[model samples]
Structures are given as C-alpha cells and as structure tokens.
Target: MATFYGGVPLVTEPIKTPRYDFVRAPIDQVNTQIKNDLLYSVSNLPVVGQTAAEQRVNKDVARQLLAKVYLRTNEPALAEAQCDAIINSGKYSLVNARYGVKAGSPGDYFSDMFFKGNQRRSQGNKEAIWVLENENPSIIVNGSSGSPQQRRVWGGGYHNINGMIPADSLGGRGLSRIRLNNWVLYKLYPQGDMRNSKYSIHRQHYFNNTASKYNSIKGLPVPYGQDKQYTLSDGTTVNIAKSDTLAKINPYTLKWGQFDPNDVFGFGMWKDFILMRLGETYLLKAEAQVKQGNTSGAAASINVLRTRAQAPQVSASQMTLDFVLDERARELLAEENRREELVRTKTLLQRVAAHNTDGPSQRQIVGLTANNLLLPIPLNEIQLNSQAVLEQNPGY
Candidate 1:
C-alpha cells in the first residue's frame, strides 16, 4: 500500500461496520507499522522445514518482505541485515544443476525451475521460498480460484501463423496480449547467457501443422525478419514478414507456457506460481549493498547468480544502480513487476525514456513526468470518506 501511494489508512483490527472519516497516515508511520508487524512475524513464524504445507508462509518470507520494505524506506543497512539473515538461515539455495522432472529433457537448468512438476520445494526446487499451488479443475473441485491468463499474456500467439498449430513443444495457444520490446529481445543479454537460451525465451517458431505443405520433415523455421518470404513445397511464396507484430510472430517468455491437450483454446493455466525465491534474495542484497557504497560486496552478490547463469561476471567498477536494475530485468523479466521495481527505485521516468521508447509508435511510453511517480488517489475513495478531508497526491 505504501509503495504505490505514499500513505494509506492503517487499520490494525477488523471493522465490523462501515466507517468513514479515516485519514491517510504518514508514509513513515505506515513503514513503521509494516516493520513492527513483519518483525513479529519473523520472531513467531515457523521455520521452513517444520511446515508440511508448501504454500504456507515462513520466517524467510517475512524476512524477504521486510528487506523489500527496508529498501523502499531507504534503510539499506536494515535491508542488508534482513537479507543476511535469510541467506545464513540455510533454508534456501539457488538451483545450479538440472534436477527436475524434465532433467533428461533438452532444457537448461535455469528454465527447469519454472516447469509445472519442478516448481514446489518437494519437487527439487530448493530456491522456491513461496509457491502458490494450483490444481487442474477437471481433477479436483474448486482447484483454481479463477482462470489465470499468464500463459496467454506471456506466450506468443504462434497458432495464428499460417503453417503453425498449437503444439506441446511450442507453448499452447496464446492471445499475445503482451509483446517484448526490442531492447529486451535483441540487446539485453550477451552471447552465452543461459536465461536467453531457447528453452527460457522461445524466440524461434517452426512450421508444425502437418496438413500444410509448408511443413518440413524437420520443422521448417518460420521467417521472422521484416519483409521476409519463404517458398513452400508447392513452389508458392508466402510473405510472413507482414505477420501481426503483437501475436503471430513475436518473441515471448516461456516461463508460463503450458499446453493442455483438452483445452487448446487455453482459457486458464493450471500451473503453480512461484511467488518468492532465493534467486531474487541475492538481487535485493546487492541493491542494499550498492546503496551503502559497498559496490564490491554488491558485485560479489550479483556474481553468484551470474556464475549460475554462466553470464559474464562483473567487477566493482561496473556495479551501478542502473546495472542492478538491468540485471533485475535479465533475471526476473516476466516474474517480477517491472513498473513497481522502477517506482520503488525512483528510476521509472528515466528508464522508460531510455529503453522502453522503441518498438511501434502506439506501444511506446509517452508523457511521463515526476508527478507519475505516485498514482493519484482515486476520486471515489476520497469522496467516500465524506467526514475527513482526504488529500490527493501532488499535481493530480
């Protein structure tokens, strides 16, 4: 609540009746309350191994959240302390080797953690601190609360292509509601980063429909470049360069891809969501370290993830706040909310203008200013509290 809006009403106890006239507390007060609550949770919550329920929250979860709160409140030392506690607890570790259900399959270790059978702690994901379990509705009643659109939003609409059909290899049918920008797709990662491997980010598409003459014995590569054309087996040319940029042939993240044979339309994704993990903890620690002018320590923290990913290691000279943000994008693209991270660091406006201004004119970010840092409080919320004068954010 304090992240998006500077201040919010602090309601500690449940209200049996509707109440108005409540005023927004100061931002510091809100942070203090959050810290107190999380400190209590850290002291009282059970350790990781004691709980049989994989979905339950533990002390490490509280510590991670508290670390994030500390970072937001400019308490870098406190944030680093929380991260140290979690790291030293020995409850979690980064997944370095291939040890999931698809261990023998053709996939990298970084991508294996995201597979359905490999998400839970019981299923070899040592990095997973919190996972929201989801079950197939056909098998269990009330299995999923609602249909999740993550797969459709993150995966590409490859089925819409001329000679392609929804296949298990290609992530199921997607509506392509979101398409990756040029900066992320082309220029983010170096040559040998495992996160940019084919298994992690499905950049290439193939002709899979057997009925189409364009289909090859060894799945013909679909053309992707601008104004590109391919000759079919029937000696006819198909212009695939003009395919829909948003859906038909765009690169997408494969983390949320799951193909359901029964539901080809893919209205819902019956997959577990990894809410918190140890991979992100290191990033948080690095951020806190960088804030305290310990760039060497920050570099060491980031190198742990880099060593696992086999990406190039950095020295203390290259450890800047901007570099940390870029590393966050590389590590947690679809998983983390990019806007929230930027807003918390106060780099949203500049970063957007630098990297997100490419791609199509319609899709580009525009008219962003300092006032956009905090969203304007809803008019209805202020009006509903008729008894008190609820102030709007500056320049609303």
Candidate 2:
C-alpha cells in the first residue's frame, strides 16, 4: 500500500495457504491502511529534534505522505487540507539565500541544499524535512562507502568526456551516466532562471591537464560560445559546435557536485543525501490546490519557489497539471522519481510519447500502452502457491 497500488495481495504471514494468499486486496483497502499508519505517527510522534533528529517521524513529512495518499484515494479536499497544515506550520521555510559554510561563496540557494554539513536542521537549513547522514567510514564502518562509489550513483558521471578530466573545480569526477532528456534541459525552465544558469549547471569544460601541449592554456575554460572551436595539443583545430560531437559534455546539472578531497580519483563523494525538503512540500500543496480547482492558490504556492529562483511567475489562468509537473522537473530534477510522478498523474504514456526523444529512437517506448502501466506479477509468486491458482496481471 505504501509503495505500490493495483490489486496486489497483502501477505501478512510468513507462510500462508495459497487460498489465503490468492485473495487480492482492493486498492482502497491498502490506501486506507497507509493513510491510517501515517496519521497515527503524525498524531503520536514528537517534533523532530534539532541535534539528534535520527529515526524521528516528522509531522510535516507524515502530512505530506497522507496528502499523497488522499490524492490517490480521490479526496482532493482532504489532500488540500493536509497540505494547508504544513503551509501554516511556520516551523519550516524555504532556504532562499546563500547560507551555511559557503554563504560568502557564489553558489545559489538551490545548490546549497545538497551541500555536505548543510543538509540538517542544526546546520541552519530549515528547508530540510528528512535527510540521510553519510559519515566517515573509519568511525561509522561502511557509513560512507567501501570503494569509489559514494557519489558516482548520483554524481552524473562525466569521465566519459573526451578531454575533461576529474577535478575539484569541475564538480569532482563524473561519468555522465545520467543524461537528461532534451525536454528537461530545453523546455523545463525559462532563460535566466538560476536553477538552469551557468552557476547551477556546469556547461563549460576547461583544459586542466598540464601534461598536454595545450598545457600553456591549462586553466583556460572553453565556453559554448557561438564559435565552437578548440586548439588541440598538436595545434590542430577541432570544430565541436554540436555538443555531443565533443568529448567534453555541456549543460550538465551541478546539484550533486560534491567533491571529496581524500578520494584518489575524485569519484567518491560522501555527502549526505537529501530525501525530502520544504521546496517539494510547496509543490505538493500546489498540486493538491490545482486538483481542487483553486487555480489562484496553486499559482501562489508555485510562485514562492519561482521567486526564489528569480524565474518568471506563474499566472492563475495558466495553472494546469502539466504545468505543475513541468515546474516539478525544473525544481526537483534528479531529486525525485520521475517515472512514479508521471504514473501517479496518469501522464506517463503521454509525456513519454511526446518528450522522450531517446526512448523512441531506441525503439524502447514503441507500442507502449496502458497495459504497460502496472508491472506483471512475478511468475515465481504464482508458481510457489500450491493451494490455489494465483492470477497474474494482464499482458504479462
């Protein structure tokens, strides 16, 4: 119920008869259980502590989960009211300025939320709702990592770039494994938006290796200027107007650019990962308000995040589910699960069919249908039960 929907059976015991296991639970029943459990925790748990905030049930997070459950349960008014509670709590506010250790630096507010030693309530970041603290492995024993993999999972691996080597200045090392869709880069935000600016996204590559012939210009940065040309070590000119044609990748997101100086290859980033923040809460509230036909309220909720980014404000007349999803991508890219969000809003097929350039080109999303929405039940689950025949999802 908490993770998935559909007519999945809830097996409560270790080994139950096939007759009992074959009985699938209704979607509403599972949603009710999830809602009850969250509300119980919200009503019984104390507020998150400032110092030892571990394993604590945050009321705002509980409310947010309940609101999501209500949205799936067809209770728009209930969802809206749950979000309203968090909005008026006054305990949490969006971090809208440079703060913490790097307040004097040139970094933006959005990027600061992910920095190490700055993702907790005690760290002066009031926006963090829930955070994962990754500590030093020497003291915490595997709390960080066993090898060179602390940040590579989310660091947007960039080592594949032709001449762009890993360094502290270039957002540590990256393999560029996670490439954004064309729509996420080009259509999600307006020009001049801080979230997509050069500061937030590392779009330039500089020659930093001193061993090459271009070593004289080692620190010379190459921008994606109109005249896309670079002189190689052999004094040969290379035209890389098309970003993909060049070894150095362009317009990569820098939100997860955490660098560990101790890492031999600069591939291990051991910063704490942010699970939930107030910025997303506002978006969730806006989504609930939009579903309830409160267009003005929805715009106001969304405008708070946009204003912080110094982007254009949204109008009440322009509020829609699609617009809300787009704003989510702009603000929460690589932070939340994209496929779940799209599936929850019933826009997976439509959005993918329209904006998924690579999917169609690779023949992956071809002939996708509603049947593809729910995953087929595992064949092992059906075969293991001997008392009764367990049914499988259609188009398995």
- Please report, as a residue range, the 10-residue window in candidate 2 with the lowest summed lDDT: 239-248
Candidate 1 residue-wise lDDT, 259-300, digit = tens: 889988878898999989998999999999999999999999
Model 1 residue 371 lDDT? 90
Whole-model lDDT values for every prediction = 0.88, 0.71
| lDDT value, residue 260 of candidate 2 | 63
Model 2 TM-score on a 0 to 1 scale: 0.86
For candidate 1, the per-residue lDDT at 246 reads 63
Tell me, what's the RMSD of every candidate?
A: 1.9, 3.6
lDDT of 2: 0.71
For candidate 2, lDDT tens digit of each residue in 1-396?
234337767655686433534756777776776787888977876666632465355777788878877876668788888878887878788888788867787777777776677887778888877777767675566676434443454444445534456765456776665666667667778977888876566766766665666565566665453456667778765454444422346456666776666663764466666777788888888888889899999999999999988998889998998889899988887788787778777889998877875533643357788877777777787777656667766777
